[model samples]
Target: MREDLTEQLSPAQIIERAEMSKAFRDVFALAGGKRVLFWMLEQCAIYTDAYTGENNSTNYALGLQSAGRKLIAKLDEIDPQFYPELLLAMKEIREADKAAAKSLAEKLEPEDDADIA
Candidate 1:
């Protein structure tokens, strides 16, 4: 049974299924491994400073994000799995939202007498 299950599941299929999962989809959809790790690090600093009563300044925030991006770049060079989906998701989400909004507006107003301003 174990052998049959192993034979049935290719590693790529397993990875894709895991990536498409509701919880993990956001992770894979965001960026690749190193970037994902860097985001986790940033979130940790935010929460940790909040708990420790450290003053969070604009400079500090900028520094943190800069560090994150730098780390992501370095990690990508070293490990080569950095996939950024933020821009792609931005386009997709905006298109989806536009379609939904258009549908709603049409439902609210008839085409012949609608004020399209």
Candidate 2:
């Protein structure tokens, strides 16, 4: 019964794996949600003072940066025009995120007038 169960599940598992693989390939090939991908990579690649011989970033962050770089290279190979798209996307997202963060901070902070009393 165990052997039969394994046999029955193998084909379904194989198909599921193939479908997931194709789905991921299509996502990258079509550049769908690539802005989100760039955002994630940008977060991973943040090294602030790492370049200044400071151990500011944790080992986990450094590892993420290394892996993110390899993924970036693969993305570049997949789309020769990726760099320009990445540049534009990064700039737009950064500005939007910065504005959103500032707005949220303003809403969350106590009023200066209230504190002055």
Candidate 3:
């Protein structure tokens, strides 16, 4: 099954694929997809840290929050009516993640010496 999926395409098929890819890129360029991709990458970093028990997820989330604010500022400069709601949504998400991180940190903290003794 894996071999079937890994099979190489013919030259014509490859050309068709390349053309389709170019078309997709053109559409994404017109739709501000780079901003969306950056947002997704930041989100992935934050969640990856959380799931892997890394200590830096909070920092990553904070960086994302900063980026979101910058993006909103840029949007405001370009057009005030363009997706202001998305900025608010991203802010809410960052706040929720911060709360969750705080809760997790509390749970993972070492016990006091008195309790251990």
* Best candidate according to lDDT: 2
Q: Which 10 consecutive positions of candidate 3 have the poorest summed lDDT? A: 44-53
Candidate 3 per-residue lDDT, tens place, 4-110, comes to 64367777876875675565455334434544634754664532433335558666666766665665555444346444544455566677879999999999998
Looking at model 2, residue 43 earns an lDDT score of 75
Global lDDT of model 1: 0.54
Q: List candidate 1 stretches off by more than 4 Å.
A: 1-26, 29-57, 67-82, 110-117
Off by over 4 Å in 3: 1-82
lDDT of 1 by residue, 1-117 (tens): 746765799999767645544444345445353245545655635324333245566557656666656655644443354324433544566678799999998899847645665
Prediction 3 TM-score vs. true: 0.34
Q: Work out the TM-score per prediction.
A: 0.34, 0.45, 0.34
Ranking by TM-score: 2, 1, 3
Give the Å error, residue 62, model 2: 2.5
lDDT of each: 0.54, 0.66, 0.57
lDDT of 2 by residue, 43-77 (tens): 76643423535555456668777877776776664
Ranking by lDDT: 2, 3, 1
When 1 and 2 are scored with lDDT, the better candidate is 2
